[model samples]
Target: MLTNYHTLKNLIIQIKPKLIHSQIVEAFTQEKDTLHIIIAGEEASALELNATGQGYIFLRPKFERARKNSLDIFPEIFGDEIRDVLIHKADRIIEILLSSGLKLIFQFFTGKVNFFLLNQKNEIIASFKNPKDNIGKIFESEKKDSNYDLMLSDFNAFKDVWESNKIENPVLRFVKSVDTIDMLTAREILHRAGELEAGRIWKALVDVGAELENPKPRIYYEGSFPRYFSIIELTHINLRKIEFDDINEAIRKFVIETRVSKSYRDEKKTIETKLNELVEKRKRTIEKVIEEIENNQRAQQYEVYGSILMANLNLIEKGLEEVELVNMFSEKGEKIKIKLDPSLSPVENAQMYFEKAKKTKASLKIAQERLERLKFEIKQLENLLDELALCENFDALKKFKEKNLEELKKFGIVKDKLVAKVGGKFKRFIVDGGFEVWVGKDAKSNELLTFKFSDKEDLWFHARGTSGAHVVLKTGKRQPSKKAIEQAGSIAAYFSQARTSRLVPVVVTKRKYVRKPRGAPEGTVAVEREEVIMVEPKLPSEEIE
Candidate 1:
């Protein structure tokens, strides 16, 4: 669900080395039972190991730079502890760590091997399995460039070397391949293997064959020295079988949630700042207006406008303020908390302050209303931005932009420019077979198309009781077919706002009976003795050019 990069980064920071190892083991392991192994000691020291549920095992040879002294058998070199571990789980782990929050690491002993698990913010949430081997040789050979390759090669060779040894589970075999692990690789393998359920690790191997056959499967190697290695762990068989619809749905949900959070944060800040500024400005303006009104010598001449007060009065007593030299009231039935000029008469002060208060209150209300509208617009714009950012394909983005432009035009947010000269224009539409239809964009257009451009024998169609574009069907000296009539009716309905309305009524008559209404709105017309047709909305895809 975490879409932001910062959130995922925090989660990775909180991951513990042991849990990373456990995750790797769990991913590769199919066994439900616990594992037992020894670390930094012989097999007789048998350590009880818990199953990590998912994991992988990797092996590497012990080697060092040449020294002047003769080489001697070093038993102590074989007992170093494993150092690096990589875990894979839901992306949530990465999200939490990247958020700069706390995380908990859990560690325990199965027998001789140590086990560890990690949770966000250091809170103990779950337990994980332990590794079967100490991985000391692999951990100590960190300086070599070919360490990762050696590890994988060693793991693959493990089967041959340990063939005579008693190993019961197939999971152990797959675990040998784990040099490194990550969410994508884990998910790819587990999902294709159909191992989301508790049991079914072998199914993963079927696809592994297909992976090995691939000429260039994706591979990942550690970026640093003492490098670890991992392949993409996916096969062509899996790619062909895997469906991404569910993944796409998850991505969409994450995008929406992110947008909502951002919108809320932005709106909150804007509303608070704007509202505070408006309140302060209103208070100051009201005081200035009251001073001017009280000092005016011709205040009495404005009695009809509203009572001008010379002295301070409660808002309830002063009532509404009138706009200067206008009939409109400004005092919105509210009290003013401003200091009154003490030099003026009570009645004069009351009238002047009341009027000022009224104006201020009205101005404040207008400001608030405008702010609300702007906020709504901002929210819509934010959603559009989010959609643009989240759209995965270029085609979808183009369609979205086009839809937004159309909506803006419909709402009068954009001005329509006269891009072309006014002249005769006609559109010919062929519908459902060979029946040709024509339509006009305006009244003059209608007259030109129907009376002049179209033949008298052709059928004419228009929306009933509504001023809309005129449609003409050119039958060309032949009776119009039912398909042609239906097609024309659809056009008539679509041109009007009632296109989506059920059973839209359309009028059909001979081209001769239709007449443009003189001095009426563009596209308005009167038809006498026309047949009515009620039809659902739909038009043929094919149109006559």
Candidate 2:
């Protein structure tokens, strides 16, 4: 409890001597949750009040002013002479009264730091943070009669709270039940009391209570990094202790060392996490590219099929699913079966295979180009990681993040979520002609996919006789190709309970025709209209988005 009642009471008593006749030069903020007020008297001093996740106030020795990125606030208080400084009751609020009758209140509640300026009437005129909430309200301390002060005042009061507190460890209980007692004080008292029965917890409380009235502040360190600051002698922790003549000096040094180091470590960890995600994404992309390159090896085989179809064009009949013909490139002259679209004529079918051969050849070239570029990008990412690993300070880590933020975001790292996907519980895939196919992952999502996520014209699919994902082919306004419908059908089969079957019948219908029956369980839907399509249960190799 660095900003505890007694500590702050002492802090104000000590700091008042310096600020008593000081003239208010300026008050400003350079960052969030922090404010600096520059005052001049016999000596120029700056009070840095930081209400971080934890609240702390430190006195910087000089009248140091931030050169840039600083905005002036409380300009009305300028040139006012400081008359008195006092703690509000037993709470962690400091009241600074000026000669002009304006009062500046600094409330240092944990996780809630608020600065307020009040008039002679005690009505708030302005505030540093949320002005609308504080303005015109008569400001007051929240814990004016809080239980912490009563617990410290008498033994019976302490015991009453101690027994009511459910925390098994008295030390942890003290920190949780008492607002002012922090972990450092609790642990020190526990250490000094040795082993105390439930009835004798009062003995442990005595040491800490006495220490609070009379503090001997010091900073504790591990190796070169400052770990903690305390007013009591922390014998429980074995660490290097640097004693300070003044509690303010101890707090200043501890806050600077620990918080700065924490910032550096936190920033470095974020960079490392993003870099690792980038490297993994690049590696996965490489694998896909490599697979595409391997698939391109069948380009000559497609060409052979095209040549054979063209050669036997006269012999081939229309409406045939497959035609057995002598292979043009087969060593043994073995007859091969080539599948065709029954709707297309013999000549059109032959040209389709030829176009497939041409596209596959071009795709091979593109894949090779993409692979080389990916390798170069991966190398660059690795170099960035190496440089980041060597960064020694917060500034160095910050500079590295600034330099590579764009590159990281380009690869889909945005803040805490890496490569955030489209908001849904469904797996999405894109088919030929940019058709988006959505497949539900569970029963609840299946209900959402069929009725909520799909439009009236969207095509929905499900395995005919077994449980399956409700698949939607999002072909808004455009009629889906037969191939696209078949792809969606394959996805429906693959996601169904009958996926292992060689061929599964999938029911296809407009989303408008599908309805959840009244009193039906989740994922159970009735179809007013449906058409069955049979297909091999094989999904597209493309990654789900």
Candidate 3:
């Protein structure tokens, strides 16, 4: 309703005489796409030019500029302003003629709203949206003939314009196609006329102008929220109305209320998007952790295999890939085939399986701890979604945001790069028995992985006697099984100089036993006690299992 020409014409007529020779002290933007200009004359007044597509302009008696986050703008026409502020014919474009051969034009046309400062030659000096092509060009307002102007007070002309247009609503025929008659004016005219007959519409159209001449400004509200404000009295939608003698005052209050409501809606949508992404990410983590826990449960089976290999070491010979033996624990007298390292003696192979079983048991505790933490995080995110539904006001949303800021940041919602940096310092993977395998990327990082990043008890691996990235099985106060070490070794072999080789020997040792010699080359480390595992050069993703 405020965008309608009749309302704008009345508003210009009311404020033009008041701003005669008023000094524009300041003009700037303090909010997103909202412009403010301060004026000092008989009374202090301000103009809020909300060029956020709605193009709502309000003249206010009192408006305090915010102390922070406000930028001063449009300094080109910031001095004295004349009272000759007029709307362009019947269009919503307001042209304010300055005494110093400059003009400030605010176009409030449909779809596109713009502000331009023009020099004496009507060339654009500056614009609000920074239209690069429009800056040096001669400004031109649209010059389409209005249906309202062509058909006013004539029944046949009104009927001809109304009949030629095919539309659903009779009110929209005037509001959408016609320029002079807006939705409010059209609805009020139809409501006053009582029907859609051409004779009645012509009479109402002629009579509506008289009503606009002496408008009783009103702001309509559904419940406590303002929905619409109009100069001419609206009889279309029934709602609570507050009448005002000053039109600008009513418009100011209504715009502020609706704009804040819109902000609240946009904020809720942002939070919901953040929460949805977080829940999906946490659920994925839970799936990975659960798979690790299931792998950890295989520790007992590894112990049984180690015991069987130790009992049958005398029967097993060296240089064998596998040995089939009767399972002592099986009631069906099942024979189990156990894989062996051909390079190791039978006793050493048995000891290696025992070591694997011990580490797998140790890794279970760490996996269980991680599983619990991930579960709690996912449940907390889901509950936060429920809590968000009750947020009604800006203060409630602000409090919700503040309360969950730390939790949201922990799950990649805020400061995402920082969260990823803390958790993803190395190329990491979860191998068998829930052990985390951390791989170095370069020569310098290889030294850090063995010395600075790894704990003393953590197992370290590298492709033996070849330039390679260091791989660390993050023991985390636990031992990792041979399967975990093998997977980590595979990752280390894949990133090394032996990557093209069919088989590579990866040396495994505790970080405590691995040390850099004095004045050693980068990534050159001497191992006091290390065991070598022979495997094909492959990454965990490339492995069959």
lDDT of each: 0.43, 0.81, 0.79
Greater lDDT among 1 and 2 belongs to: 2
- For all predicted structures, in order, the TM-scores are 0.24, 0.59, 0.68
Tens-place lDDT per residue, model 1, 495-528, is 7767778778998988778776778765556777
Pairing residues by index, what is the TM-score of model 2? 0.59
- Candidate 2: count of backbone clashes, pairs at least 3 residues apart or interchain: 0
Worst-scoring 10-residue span by lDDT in model 2: 413-422
Candidate 2 residues lying further than 4 Å off, grouped into runs, are: 61-69, 142-169, 172-180, 196-200, 221-227, 238-241, 302-325, 337-362, 365-545
Per-residue error for 470 in candidate 2, Å, reads 51
State candidate 3's TM-score: 0.68
The alpha-carbon lDDT assigned to residue 109 of candidate 1 equals 14
Q: Write model 3 residue lDDT over 1-545, tens digit each, in one string.
A: 66767778888888888777987888888887788889888999888887765578889875889999998876876776674787887577898888777888888876677888899899998888766867898987775455665666567877877777888788897676556777767888889889877778778877776777898788888755678888877888799999999877777887888878788879788878888887787688778878887988888888888889888878999999999999999999899999999999988988888888787876776677667756776788888889888887778888887898766654445554432543545677667655667787777878877787788999988899888888888776766777778878888888899999978999988889999999999888899999999877765431111
- The candidate maximizing lDDT is 2
Ten contiguous residues with the weakest lDDT in model 1: 21-30
In order, what is each prediction's RMSD in angstroms? 26.0, 18.2, 10.1
lDDT of 2 by residue, 1-545 (tens): 56766678777777789989899999999887788989888878889888666678877866556699899989999999999998877577899999999999988876777889999999999998889888999987766566665666677877777678887776788777666676777777767777655445567676577876788887887766787777777888999988877888877887788778888788678877887887899799999999989999778888888899999999898899999999868799999999988999998998898888887997887688668767877887798889889887777777776787656544444341412433657898755544679888899889877777788899999999998899999876888889889989999999999999989999999999999899999999999999999987876545454
Ranking by TM-score: 3, 2, 1
In candidate 1, which residue ranges exceed 4 Å CA deviation?
Answer: 1-341, 375-379, 382-390, 398-545
